[model samples]
Target: MWHPGLVDVVYATVAGALLSTAVVAARAGSPHRTPSRTALVAAVGTLGVSFLVQSPAARGVQNHLVADLGQLTGNGTSLVAAYALRVMVLHVRYDRDTAAARARRWLVALVVAFVAMTVLFLATPTVPGRFTSPDAPAGVVAYYLIFTSYLGATLVSLALLLGRYLDTAGGRWSRLSLHLHRAACVAGLIYLAGRVVALLVGRPRLEGSGQRFNLIELGVTILMPAVVAVLFLLGVLIGRGERWLRHRRAYRRLRPLWEAARAARPHAVLPVTGGGARLRLYRRIIEIQDAQLAAAQVLDAAQRRRIDGAIAGAALTGESAAAVREAALLAAGLAVLRDGRAAGGDGGPVTGAADQEVDLSAAVARLERVSAAWTGSPVVHRLAAPPEPANPR
Candidate 1:
């Protein structure tokens, strides 16, 4: 009985779209970005052109042969979008640098193609008829042929690319990529076949065959591709969803253990037995896990490893790890306090200990309670990373 709100679907779709778009943006930065995303964007655009551009031009088609000249003209955009998407998907899947270059070349080919389609529609003559109107019979045929040929060419090339990719991908990535590409190809073919069917079937509506054909086309052709599009999109989303879910589940699943550690410990402050008040602080800094998730006890081991790696990689990446180190140190200081060493309020003044007014006991108590009452019931780790200077260096 619980249905998702309209906003939820919209947000999910938008997030999916954004996920694809981010790949495009990343493609711009990293040649390693998959071309499948680019193709998906284009595939959607091509279908959009049929509904958004061509369908609207339905008016006046009965009277004027070239009544919807603009609709025909708009084929240019669809051609470019579809071609790019199909080609890019192949390229990404197959690691085809040539495909990228070929994509640019084919884009130029589209202008030439449109010009040819326009000239044929304008000059060439045909008999006045029902669906094959004389205003531009040659144009229509040429357009169909060109579009069909494009589909054939694009599909074959993509199949080749996919074949090459399958041979190379070898394992998990290959399996996923293979499926994604296969679905994409099926989607492309479905749309292309639908358009082809519509043109053929729409020609005879007056004979009753036309209506039947249109109906059949709508189901068998039109919606078939739409269905394929839906499936393809779902697959993409499922892949992303699985990744997101894995991280989330891991975090949730591991959360309890982390929190249990904190719960079991009677003292929150690190038991600072030596002048090394900084030691506890250091441990806290490392265990804090970026002051966000670990303290809240929702951090997963994967996330923990990621944070650890980030810390490890900071020097290589030129990122400052001081803040993370500082949080760790603070946590460690709390640990020391629980050990009764910080009885003198931050040890009465170690070099960097008295720098801040953080309530070690209260902070840990509040945080521990939060951990105990976690709705997610995630795990937290004991802080152990060495602390940085309390004053950021």
Candidate 2:
């Protein structure tokens, strides 16, 4: 038998996950609003609110009016959520004309189901604080049948739609999100099936004729929804999560070059603050650029020629070549600064003309390569190292 406390925890967790997913999806921006995006946000938000109302603590409230209201609201909102999900999937899988035509029919069906369920809920003779029970009245049974049928059909349609999309998904995150959404749909179907079985069989009876807890029923009611909610949440956030991870990796990779530049000319580092991984990385790049400019003041023509020769001899191409060339020059500049050999000459171009014209993403890519060469490339290390002097006896 499942513990009551554990069931409550599971309910709370599912509610929280759904709510969080709704917020994340709503905040995920696009160039402009679309039917798919709007439906997705609405579906998750209503679903989350349904779970919150049906939560154990909410149901346990002392007021009978609040408890009855919660039951009706939960059922009503969940119907809306299921309808919204159907609309979302339609928009995603079909063109606007076809999707809108189909969505109107689904909307009519949703209205009929919701109205029927609400009527049954009101007609059912139930206790003041309880709407659903194992030995429910025929009206209550009819109410649940409508709820489960609508929800199950919606989940099945979503599963089919997502499965088709999964096959054509181009990106890694896109495939992963589709896979997760399909899994959530399957879980929702299982939850619906379990509810149907529970409604039919009622709770198990103990030898003493007392009510016996059913683990399968508890799992279906509590754990299954949690699984569905978490999977859906993951699907919605997978793209953002992957992008954040990529930015973080880039930020870490650029640290070596960033540190070297900042250490050579501390004053060149910017005082800007308060940003996420991507923003911090942008600021770091700007600081490194400023440091390059500061070190350029000391770098002489002879050092630039030597660095250029070393880079050309390395036979690197594309960004690799650019990075090595930049690394060599920056190393030379830092050396000149340390040796107090401040030529104060016009250092000319510290980077290739092409480098200055690249976008922020390309600049970051090149800088990441520079960071790798700053500490790892043998040619860069050899060129950057100071010349060894020989003493005659």
Candidate 3:
């Protein structure tokens, strides 16, 4: 006779937790809903179901261990099937809504209640050893059929989901999901093939009042669920990792942009060169000009107007406080623009000093030319696509 020992119990418990976690995560990540609030409740029912199969409480009074184990496993098999079906359908109808996200929550709660009640009902059945009467083979058969129906529902739901995904998402992503989707479909097919055969032939008869074929059924049962779990987890992990890595890289790139904007004062555009190079060096000139404009804004109004007019008329050069001050202004602007500081702003330009003229009119002219050139370019418009979670491998 087969026995539900420590190893079997432990494995079932752990598997229950893992499956629950995976299901909850997938649902939570769904666009339509949040995490299932009562995922633990569903897991508890699954654990209880597993435990009953592993350790039938009526082993002493009703040594019908096969019936007990078969019923429990069959029921659980069906429950899991129904869960899969619900997940698939819910995902399709889903919109990240408060109600939709609670899909598993309420259903799981009912399952827990049913499981608890079943445990109580089983504790003291009409017959001492058997949960069902010898005449109840029809009911037992019907129960198995219910589970089979759930599995069928799950298969259809998955097929629908795959079709919808292909129709909506195109290109490489379509190809990728198809890989996992096909694998999962095959796994389901394997399960259906085995279970349908078992249903038609009926559970194998035992010899000598011991489980002769229970072990065979158990082996197939464990194998199918295990394979499905592995494939599903593999797909989920890869998708999640891809999304996270892309987000991390993008954040690292943009981080410096934000930091630089905060750490220094703004300046005007200026350039060290003129002519064609001005267009190429526009970023540098813009940085310089922004700094110059900021410095001017901080100066007294009269001093600012006078210097602005002087620079407008001619360059900053000569040999006196006037020329030196204007050259200093130009130098400070260029320094801040190039090195991202206010160093040369207060010092002097490379070639000109106090009482010298440093022409900036050309820099101003370049800004307009560049602006017009940009404005004259042909405008191209395309539809905006939704952001991708991650780039395809």
Q: Using Cα atoms with residue i matched to residue i, what is each candidate's TM-score against the true structure?
A: 0.46, 0.60, 0.45
The TM-score that candidate 1 achieves is: 0.46
Error of 3 at 324 (Å): 38
What is the per-residue lDDT of model 2 for residues 1-393, given as tens digits with 9 covering 90 to 100?
556566667767777777787786566543346898899889988888888877766766623564365667777888899999999889988899999999999999999998998788777757753454466677877888999999889999989888887778776887898899899999988888877766676644433443343555567667788888889888878956776777788888888878887677776777756666666777787777776776677666766777778777878887787778788777777766656664654666666554563366677777888888888887788887435334778
Across 1-393, the per-residue lDDT of candidate 1 in tens digits comes to: 112243234333433453454454344332223566656556654544443333322323522755555445445655765676666765665556776777778777777777776676556544432223322354576676776676657766666666776776544643574677566676767666666655554454536464555466446433554455455555555555554443343334334324433543434424436422223333343233223322323222443354446556544221124334323333433444334332222222111222232544333433333333233211113343222325756
Candidate 3 stretches greater than 4 Å from native:
1-10, 13-70, 73-81, 84-88, 94-136, 166-178, 203-219, 262-393
Q: Residue 7 in model 3: shift from native, Å?
A: 6.6
* Candidate 3 C-alpha error for residue 66, in Å: 12
Clashing pairs in 2: none
Residue 182 deviation, candidate 3, in Å? 5.0
lDDT (CA) per prediction = 0.47, 0.76, 0.44
Cα-based RMSD of candidate 1:
14.7
Model 2 worst lDDT window (10 residues): 204-213
Best by lDDT: 2
- What tens digits encode model 3's per-residue C-alpha lDDT throughout 11-61? 565456455654655444322232332432343345344433433342332
